[model samples]
Target: MKKLHHIYIISAFLLSSCSPKISSLITKDYQSLKYDEKVVVLGLNEQQPANAEVLGVVKVRDTGFSTKCNYEIALDKAKLEARKVGGNTIKITRHKKPDLWSTCHRLDATILKI
Candidate 1:
């Protein structure tokens, strides 16, 4: 048990389990973007209203930090970039576990507009 506990603790520092890291944003291949519009952030369980069109997909890879707090920061960054592309809403598609030690949190969202 001691060895297991030590390993977990060590992982936190090495992987930044709960730390907030910089968000690596990906936004592209979007056509018909509406700029200067209000955007709504939605989680997986949340439902989006009617007549909304999907703008584009945005992926955020937040490293060093791997926690909800960090994801929120990354989400904020994603939203900011989405707005620039005229995204009025974002529907989070999926979240994945760390693919590697340095790359901690991975968030996938779909940008939408009405």
Candidate 2:
């Protein structure tokens, strides 16, 4: 029974550690909102939403977790932050590469709404 418990605990830890996560740091302020499925991620030079308004900016942080985290995770986190800041769209404007192990990443983006 003790061996079984140990195995279970280790398994749980391993599983959790395998998942990727990213966080948002507010660079601008706006009315708080709940991110919706309608939110869109605009291209670097997407021209369609030229008239879209800027809500704010956010700095996305991700500690490139043990090969578990990827670029997509960081980008998604930035988009989510944009949505929460009362925007419907997100456009990453800058990127900071991580160290040799990719243990840290920073993404700067503009939050916009149509």
Candidate 3:
């Protein structure tokens, strides 16, 4: 019984630590830009799956656990910018709950201009 208790505690800690945190793009202000223009994002830590396709604009809401905020944009336009950038990583800013509640995930990406 004592060993089982220890296992449970360890598992709980691991699960809590692995939980995903809210993240947003930290670049040019997303609010001021036009919807049709592509924004550039930098310093993204994770690589988006190669197979993942931008499926139009999505407004994601935070569920407080294993979930995060969302945004909306033109799918084809976003993909075009992503391909032009030549890098899979996009910029994002992380947010926490209670102290950090917001209506939208502020994120945008832009292709480097040659």
Candidate 4:
């Protein structure tokens, strides 16, 4: 009985530890911009030095902009970049004005990692 109980507890702990957390954020935003905009560069860091990596890309809703692009970088990098730019803040910069079909908006953010 004790052995079975120990196995159950270990299994539960492993399951919880393996589960990945799903989080989302809007790295860039363009409000009422007629032309499309492009992001030139992005900087990311962490509050408490930690290694980070780019995960993937996240889709952002169109807010009357030309084109919108979002990226899923490492959480640690995101947090660091965020703190650098503006703690818990998102920064958006436009390189060129929108044309018609698409507007370019770049995402420059950082977040904490595990």
Candidate 5:
């Protein structure tokens, strides 16, 4: 029993240290953008383009066992989600850096078409 418990703990740790998680809520449907299409990323305080239209929201977070959710990676994932939802821009709504309880960056952004 002790050996099995140790094995489970090690397996969980190994898995958690492997991958981050990304999620999105798409409110409007549009033709998906091409892979090479550009998706502009805006900071939290940055103003969106005047012609912007809301598409949905996206979030990049660390699963309890996730280890690779750094700021750059999270931001990129958000942008990718935006493009998939046919958004031409993404405005960051929130950002949380790694802290005592978490070793990953978390991001939230609003997807838009401009």
Candidate 6:
């Protein structure tokens, strides 16, 4: 019974390690931009460009099962969402680093068109 319990725990760990990250976006009508256009990333305290137009909000997070939830991966996911909504820049609003409960980076960002 003890060995069976260990096997179950190992199986659960393996399943979680293979899970994919999740992302969400909320936006209005905006023309999608070309992939060739570079998407700029802004820090939490960074000031947005004066001529920038707000496009939408983006969030990337670990679903408790996500494995490769690193900062770069999360940021890239947010940028992809921004590009889909015609945003040329992303302003990071909240960043949650890996903690005891989750071994993944999470972020909330505001998409903008400059």
Error of 3 at 21 (Å): 3.8
Q: Count clashing residue pairs per candidate.
A: 0, 0, 6, 20, 1, 0
Worst 10 residues of 5 by lDDT: 15-24
Give the per-residue lDDT of model 3 (tens digit) for 58-110.
11233344322333322233334343334232333332223355443433433
What local lDDT score does residue 46 receive in model 6, on the 0 to 100 scale? 93
lDDT of each: 0.66, 0.67, 0.37, 0.35, 0.87, 0.83
Give per-model CA RMSD.
Answer: 10.1, 4.9, 13.7, 16.6, 3.9, 5.7
Candidate 1 lDDT by residue in tens digits, 45-82: 98876787766777776545445544667677567667
Q: Is candidate 2 or candidate 5 better by TM-score?
A: 5
Give me the displacement of residue 5 in model 5, in angstroms: 19
Instruction: Give the alpha carbon lDDT tens digit for every residue of 30-99 in model 5.
Output: 8889878988889989998888999999988888888678888888788888878789899999999999
Write down the TM-score of every candidate. Answer: 0.55, 0.57, 0.21, 0.21, 0.81, 0.77
The most accurate candidate by lDDT is 5
Better model by lDDT, 1 or 6? 6
**lDDT, candidate 6, residue 8?**
100
**Model 1 — which ten-residue stretch has the worst lDDT?**
20-29
Candidate 2 residue pairs in backbone clash: none
The deviation in Å at residue 2 for candidate 2 is 24
Write the residue-wise lDDT of candidate 2 on 1-114 in tens digits.
Answer: 999999999988777665444445555556656755566776556554668777767775543344544567667777777767777778777776666656655677778877
Off by over 4 Å in 1: 1-38, 63-69, 97-103
* Clash total of candidate 3: 6
Candidate 6 ranges with C-alpha deviation above 4 Å: 1-25
